[model samples]
Target chain A: MSDAYAVRDNILTHHFSDGSGCIFFDPMDNSMVAATKPVEELLNKEKSESDEQHCHIINTLLIHKMITKL
Target chain B: MCRRIYGDRFTHSIQPSEFIDFRIGIKYPNFTRRFLKPQVQFSSEGLVPFTPLPADYAFAMLEWGMNWTVAMYEFQRVIIHSAVLAKDDYAILLPAPPGSGKSTATAYLENNGWRLLSDEMALITKNTTQVTPFVRPICLKNASIDLCKQMFSHGTFSETAYKTHKGDVAHMSPQRHSIEEQSTPANIVGIVFPQYSKDILLDIYPMDKTSAMVKFSENSFNFNFLGQQSFETNVHLIENTRQFELHYSDLSEVNAFLNEEFCK
Candidate 1:
């Protein structure tokens, strides 16, 4: 339902979540911001979303293809 | 006068503790009286005031503050020593001196159900690394006495301390319900050094860890005598906690803002 975000620097970083949503705090001015899932919490959610998940998928497929060649 | 303001009152009472005497009575606003009051010999000698105030009233006030200081150490497993408050598991440690409006902030926060850790001392056992809960009467001085009376309206405040340097301070005993249910061991989530300012909005800020430690040491009750033990405890606490400096004036706004910001 509600996620807890720590107040750090100028940006809010991902901590832990309930898979429902996440929360973040602005350290510069101390404000609360929330990131919700299935809406504004996915890759389509923000421009700064990490690409690590896609890279992992591609790496797994590459490994599978190499095994087939062997 | 008793060497310092703190010396005279506790001289006869503090003899048996065997806790180290670091001579740190006034430095730390929170690491206050180490133990409670011993039975006073009113008809004997010293601080014998003939101010028409009842002996029971004066004796009880002194006993309450002193006993409160000890209740923390003896029962450190259940309370948080920090000055801050939160809505859920939220807590903040505010360490400041007398005129900083801490009482005003505390009254406001408790009204919001943040729970009172202690208005006097922040008890921490050297080994357990936890804060102890001390739910006693909240002592308010001078103008704050009147202000709090107006604010709480129905609070049971003791007769105000008369002819004292800090002014006619009064202790407001918490409701029976609060005293019974307001005890918990909170994590030291954040540290704040509050400097009250009027006309300012709510400000949630941070402080560097090392400097915060030094400030905390200065705020210790028996740190000097405890020597290495107190030093070690300070180091561990600073490492495990977030530190900050809060400068604000309005209690209602700060209270609402912290509940929203830290608890949610």
Candidate 2:
């Protein structure tokens, strides 16, 4: 039920040069998940009503240790 | 044939080394059929015995078993199924599936001027762009066997083993310099996906870095196993290196193109 969440720059979020997709990498435990369109939109600061859904996805990933909670 | 071809290669090593890194003991079962036509099985430390092959093809089995051991057991580096050759500290990754003429191009490139890092795999560090050398004999299969012999006449080659899974196969001896400088690490400059085409002269297609990264990740042996480290390493590689899809028939043309592109 933690609320605060932030993606870091170093190894957390990787922006692709070819615009294919970004990947979120966890350094603590060698885990990774491909960024979905919703995640990308959130990351790019695009307008969307699915903000809670995107955050939920990230939070679920955090629960799985695929990402970290800020 | 393996011993005969790689005899001088072993001498290049300063310290005493075994004929093969993996001590695979080849044994034959005793039976009436075994006496009539013997079969050779490969067994190593802690590994179950591999299926038996005809006694004549024992050398080929040993070579394949050794390669399998490395590809399966080694997890330190992200092993890419590619042929790597280097020149002036810049490495060229030749990644392709089987029968794509990767080995032939590698053999030609190594003999011409480029130093051979490995023909089977490129052991790349997960944290950095550093590639470790697993210098061994370059395997030439099917038609490549004759082509290699014709192209590099002076190069020592093993006796051809016929009709064992991949048709005819032989081992091409690596250059003395490559063996001596086996431990030297090379920075990757370009990743080329080469395809041999009879009609094509030389078709070079540029690849996007992200697409190239996906392809590289797909071709890696332990990319999934290494996880985040593999991701970081791949990202580092794609960001810093050029990627291409080269369809070539002529070695000279390919060599010239590589020289013009990477050597500068």
Best by lDDT: 2
Candidate 1 stretches with Cα past 4 Å from truth are A1-70, B1-87, B127-129
lDDT tens per residue, model 1, B1-264: 222222222365555657742221211112222223212222211232222233334533453435444532443232233354534455566677878888777776777677776676666666544565556667677778888889888666676667565666677765544454456755555566777876987676765554566566567665534544555566567666766677887787766656555666
List residue ranges in candidate 2 displaced over 4 A. Answer: A1-13, A18-21, A24-39, A42-70, B9-21, B29-34
Candidate 2 CAPRI-style tier: acceptable
lDDT (Cα, 0-100) at B63 in candidate 1: 36
Worst 10 residues of 1 chain B by lDDT: B21-30
CA displacement after TM-score superposition, residue B218 of candidate 1 (Å): 1.0
lDDT of each: 0.53, 0.78
How well is each residue in B90-152 modelled by candidate 2, as lDDT tens digits?
Answer: 899998998889999999888889999999899898767778888888988999999999989
